[model samples]
Target: MAFDSQWGLSATGFYVPSYEEVLDSIQDDFIARFGSDIVLTSNSNFGIITRMMARREKASWEEQQLTYYSAFISTAIGTSLDYIGGNLGLKRKVDEPAFATITIATEGEYLIQAGEQFATESGYVFTLLKDVVTTQNNDGSWSGMGMVQCEETGADTNVPINSITTEVDPDENILSVTNFEKAGGGQDYEDDETYRERLRMENEARPGSTAAGIRSALMNLPGVREVNIVQNPSNATDKYGNPPYSVHIYCLGGDKGSIAETIADYIAAGITLVGSQQLKVKDATGNKLDINFDFATNKPVFAKVVINTDDAWNVDNGAEDVKQSIADYINELEMGDPVYITRLYPAIYDIEGVTDASIAIGTSTTTLQEKNMIQTDFEAVTCDPDDIEVVVNGL
Candidate 1:
């Protein structure tokens, strides 16, 4: 068969000729045209030329294959993905800084100005979101709460509670600084896999009161991590106490108002919205209607990792590195996704000196889990760096 005829779109799928196949086709043509008497060994100059020609032809076929795949979301990547996302009205999310509330105690009445930087021991810096003026308390000390945002983007800034203890530039009046709650909402730029998934969802999403459509719309919102909608489609109230034809939306990490508004826009009229949290959203006629949705609770996943390492391992930071890696993987999981102990192997092995590792995960520290930790649809697994304990066996 001709080289060109062997590769291209077939009934099965897009196909491309391998390097060896292309070379064989070229040699067969050469022998058919010039007769078998012609020298055709790798040592021969003609054979070398033939091999080079085959390589070039194979490269062209690969490029054509890439072009074909690039038109579809499933296989497209990088700039091609960006192009498809733009056409679908889906812009890739950029990295966002983490934000948390920090408590500032002062020896005397002091003003914690906006832009004052605080840092964790690991050196992640965060700036106060707004000015916080301290008020005198009964004991003559002053304290106030201030919201702060990490100066940098990414998950590393989502430090654990009490991690932000250092003041980047020490202020004499500000006696101490610490975060009682873990900083959250930090995210890396949406990767190709995630972006492609979103594109697929958006492409299939229709404009109507649909579970998939509502979930897709909510997922596109900034800070919205996961969304699950459970509908009681029966004529009577379901076991979950949802009224007839009611939907209970469980979402994690999105503005409550935005969630309410999006639910209002997508939900069909006369359908009862069910949840614990309620927010008033304006309807199309500018009338306010109460919308309800439950914020998915975080199922804190504690892990104990024992790693066998060699001399090549980074002794000082290796444990923390492993902890952070595990935390990152756990935090990235969507709502109700089980915490698979086996899935953490890749993240652990990615560390330079890790030879072997064993991981145990559970919802609480008291109970140990060998099997995957399952969660309800309204729960998302959360793992703080501090929650992950790493032990190096052979450091």
Candidate 2:
């Protein structure tokens, strides 16, 4: 009886049902009566129901049409979010922007020879030669003075005025001077203390000074944007409160591999360390550039890593796979022993598709519903190269 009332509609004389009738039909409908409004409603009611049904059907059809669409979208978004969550990846993308910062760590001894002494109004000239020597043009009033000088020492008073001299041998005490002045003719114009101090200052200011040498050495490498010398106060002071000297280099441009190689070559060429140690370049997040040098042995060690991943349709799944692959690859790398995970990232892609089929009496053919799942690739990496091992286990 309830089904009869729910399925049956009171005949409204106007050919189609009213808004009220449709509502009543939905509330009362039992099975077959549910769709009765398709034929019973007035034009306006019929049109409204038809449009609403069409939209609802479209959404439902879309869901069934593609199995992987949602999966792919979700994976991409989720993986990217995870990557950004790590600080190193964020800073690298933001601060480094277009270039990568690389650090070269090395240690070696330099062979230096102190040059001839000369007299000038400002002071005495004592030229020091080291490595394959090349001289730069002298600017200002001090120009064309082949040698740098300091105040004459008493020991040099009896020596010949124009005598050209050469200094001590190679690999000697690091802090000792290679040459010294014997007693000379003029009023002991150069004081050894004053001479040494002036030379220190001049070498620091000269373009061929230790700082300049390091800069020049690095600039010779390809893609080096610029170089800066920074002093580290923490290590700058000695136990006796004397000022310790150090060189901090700022390097930009080039990928990690090229930069590391250039640095190794420079170390092998004999750049001396001002103090007992040196500092390397680091990112904003304090991630150190890949570089190593053995000062004791005068040998430089370098590490290089390359990562590649398969295409991924899902971010979460793809990132996992990439993380695992990177870990596995790193384990197989010989040079990557000192390497640690530094950062990870997710690259995402979007895909879409649809299918429709129909049949008519004239065609006399049956239509089958069609559906498919789209495919895509996702990529990600671990921060520490060594962490790749851990990622493999987790993946």
Candidate 3:
């Protein structure tokens, strides 16, 4: 590492001389080489060239510092961060399609084949994952539950509950189809900071059957965003009805087969797993084992915003801007975090010309509140621009 008037690689790290210092050094060198009597005013050709050189030098040093920082985990970004994660055997999570549980009805018993396509009013399509045979309910209506995935990916497709009412291409036997809950698990490609954090977690995680180790391994799986483990150590069944010496794992995203396989590999032999969804997987010895875990749900959050704005507001886009900002805040919240009414204020005030604002939050539009809405750990809160209603200038 050599120290220089412009820049240096030293003991602490990369360093660069300040603009003023660099300018003075260059001026001194000019005087030494030529003479002090030379004119170097701001208007002079020599002065302009000197300043330009100084600026270019500082910019080059700053770029070098960034390049140096990219080699380490904490300071790395973008593709550099992806490379570090890759070295740890972790690939960044990519975009995922939104999933929905839809109920289909028919006038008579009918086999709703896999690949049946349904849609929302906006024309977003969802394809059924498996075949379902409709049955008569106690009410005498024929219906069955079908799991669907959006034809396209990303969070934009997480439509509201009951919004998937249309059948794409039309089905003669199917009388109606609708989603009971909001579609969820639709996520954009993982961002740099999030990918970097996962890389750090994977680096520190050790290989074992312990809870921490199992969680870390599962988190490394693509499409998996959140994980939770509940252990029942006593001889009696727990409150969630887990048998003695059993474990319950709840995950928000990831492929079912991969999730089961990861659990089978990390969990100790003979530990009973409990969940609604179950699959069989082979362990290290080629012994088949049952792995169970539930897919967590996303609870829809509705918000209402009343704001007073000044003339600076662009009337055409002001309402839209507020809705998007608030929706982003709500959607980014972690699973089980409570939605505070006051927290919505900052998002609204961030919009230009919004002098004052008040907000309300609720699980449903009818039950909105001026305070916070509590959420259970099993569910994540989700919001979209359509879920947020905006009133501008008290109109």
Candidate 4:
């Protein structure tokens, strides 16, 4: 017979005293109680002891009922929530290394076996995860692609296989080793803010909520930056198999095996459909429903920023930094988010450059064509360092 609109929401009523205020209040109280018996002298041991005691008092109060939410609160709240999630089997994921394929050209017949190692210009060592047979091409030359895994984890390892430090074969002196495509999936450990958001959702998510559970499951995998799930979203054949009632998940920055395993676990019920959208795998007598797992489709966008050369071009006027900053900002954007062409200007100005800048999504042309926004509806958008071009006054 009663109705409450905001039942779940909690109204916070708390205040944290500032450091200075705490000291002043402590001094005021001490003086009031002592009535001029104590002198306000910083040089005195009493003063030092008084301030330390006051700060300790404030610290105890703050720790007990922390109203302010900073990293301190992140650690505080996170510690409890961390335990709660642990009980629920939702542990925070660790960092993961990136993977890439390097095309190694050999002069003579060479077997680029797995475990073979090479270092980049940045001193990052990568190992061949799979063997590549350097067979003769039509020209009778030897070249093969080797799947390489970065030895280190973190975004810094996501480099453009710059150069080959050690030659695969000293005799043939391998023609050259280069990565046409950039390595990806490398990411740092989840920060407090991101981890907090994920923790917020775990408690409220409904059971069998495909969107919530699947996204959480995929995100739990290390290096997975983002995830998007579409369930029989459109009449058109979807990216995953186009089966009716089927869910297609596009994930960014995750290991292939982990992503695949998460998908399998999500659909483990023998009744789980393999390819069909509407029917469960065990329940369906028709074709099997498909559970697909793959990296988020990367829509690479290039930027050409036009800036004053004479005034702006200098050592601090780092064009490279601008490019990397812009690409990092763009890559961090959510999947399916559109890229605003003009938005790249801030990225340019953020650099230590002298002045003004203009941006073009794919071309350096000053004329504004339809290059305003890069449409991403079903895929994640990424910006590699190679895709950005920073020009100094068009010269």
Q: Please give, for residues 1-395, the per-residue lDDT of candidate 1 as tens digits.
A: 34675479988878998889999899989999989998889999779978989989988888889998998899998999898888888889788888888999998778888999999988899999899998888888889999888889875566777999999888788888888876767766888988888888888985358899999988887667788889988899887778898889998765566778988888888888889889899988898888999878867889888889988899889999999999989988988888888898999999999999898888777776677898876899888899877888985
Compared with the true structure, what per-residue lDDT tens digits does model 4 show for residues 233-306? 55566665556655656777665555655566564353223322122132234444445544566666766766
Better of 2 and 3 by TM-score: 3
lDDT of 2 by residue, 105-173 (tens): 112233223442223222343333222222233331111112233334322222222333322232322
**lDDT tens digits by residue: candidate 3, 1-395:** 11264366778887877777677767777777779987777778878877777777777777888888888999999888888877776788788888888999999799998998999999889999999999999999999998999998876777778999998878788899999877776667988877877777777875458887888898876667787788999999988788999988888766677789999999987788899889999989998898898877767888888888888887999999999998888877877888887788888888888999888888789988889878777787878789889888733
Which rank order by lDDT, best down to worst? Answer: 1, 3, 4, 2
Please give the RMSD to the true structure for each candidate, in Å.
Answer: 5.4, 28.5, 4.4, 8.4
Cα shift from native, residue 84, model 1 (Å): 2.1
Q: Among all windows of ten consecutive residues in candidate 1, which has the lowest summed lDDT?
A: 1-10
- The lDDT values for all models are 0.85, 0.31, 0.83, 0.65
Query: 231 in model 3: Cα distance from truth in Å?
Result: 2.4
Stretches of candidate 2 exceeding 4 Å from the true structure: 1-44, 56-395
Off by over 4 Å in 4: 1-14, 36-88, 99-114, 118-125, 128-148, 155-167, 170-185, 201-209, 233-241, 268-291, 307-325, 342-355, 363-370, 384-395
Measured against the true structure, the TM-scores of the candidates, in listed sequence, are 0.73, 0.18, 0.80, 0.63
Best by TM-score: 3
lDDT of 4 at 172: 54
TM-score of decoy 4:
0.63
Model 3 scores worst on lDDT over the 10 consecutive residues at: 1-10
